[model samples]
Target: MSPIELNKRQEEILQIVKNNGPITGEQIADRLSLTRATLRPDLAILTMAGFLDARPRVGYFYAGKKSAQALGDTMNNMKVKDFQSMPVVVRESVSVYDAICQMFLEDVGTLFVVDEQSLLVGVLSRKDLLRTSIGRQELNQIPVHIIMTRMPNITTCKKSESLIEVSRRLIEQQIDAVPVVAEEPAGLRVTGRITKTTITRAFLSLSESHEL
Candidate 1:
């Protein structure tokens, strides 16, 4: 991994924190004649990338981790299950019409498809349903299995995978989410779900916690 490259201001902030250990972000900003709000993002990056540590009601302190390796180490330490959301799954036998209703009710962009054995079989997306529903009036009669993107074609993640890697795959494939699955004797078993929103929330929570 490459070392975290910082702009002049970030460098200055680090120097300040190093000199005055445990100094508040507000104080660091004051030294640079900037507002705390302007420094929020820099502080978050520094802390998250492992250059610094933040303590609530206290302040920021340098962690002294090697910049080149800290980012990977910090990200890898965050397990998917620690931040994953509960999965919304539907059976392969479910009707396309009913699946649409479930999607609206659940308010999710994707759904995991499972079989009678509760093993993952496929996936359902709004696009899949819309395409299938275009001229079909028998949505009630048509099952999701007929339209779902099946296994091997579907991208999946494990509970033990890191969020960094999972989020990367989500963007690369241009998919909104992926099911967190476990390899069972029969097949892959859906355990949870990870989405772009879920990752956004996780980062937001991390940044918010370290905000001054």
Candidate 2:
């Protein structure tokens, strides 16, 4: 089914119902600082549009899976650039131990590996460092480039791409994050990153935007 298009007020109403329902119409109106009369039309539309369900004594409730689907559709329409987080970067020539320290200091699961020109060259995950660190006494002497996932093999997304596509890549690749990049005269330059945490924040923002 085609998703219902909601105006600001309707979205606000749906959000309220999702949070505080099964709540009375009068209560919802009170939260919005509008009279029940003023809110009647919105309530009617939401009920008819299948975004809400009302019970006689219990008040109103969100329409369950349909509401979830609507939120998912909205998220899918949002662009990756709109929600991508700042990337933690390290030079390819940096030692593996130093890179690990940087990752811990920045509190990120992955780090974008870049060249001297700041062009994206590879990607390094915690797993990569862990595998390399085991039984290795020369971690501080080994460059990250030796173990990083190189370009063309690394999953990346452009700023113009949708969040849906980025989320798909995160799941399908079994990776924690994807670098957001732009094509340059020299190579791909890392601008940002989309991670599982970023997606969680996006969901929270979407939910909070509709709150009372």
Residues 1-212 of candidate 1 have per-residue lDDT tens digits of 44456666778888999999799988998999998856765675577667898999899998875544443555676667666777899999999999999999999989999998999999998888889889747999999999899988999999888889898999999898999999988999898889998789767655433333
Clashing pairs in 2: none
Weakest ten-residue segment in model 2 by summed lDDT: 64-73
Q: How would you encode candidate 2's per-residue C-alpha lDDT over 1-212 as one tens digit per residue? A: 44445668888888999899899999999999998855664675466446788899899999853433455555555677566778899999999999999999999999999999999999999999999999547998899999999988999999888878888899999999999999999999999898988778656555543343
Give candidate 1 misplaced runs (Cα > 4 Å).
1-72
In terms of lDDT, the poorest run of 10 residues in model 1 is 203-212
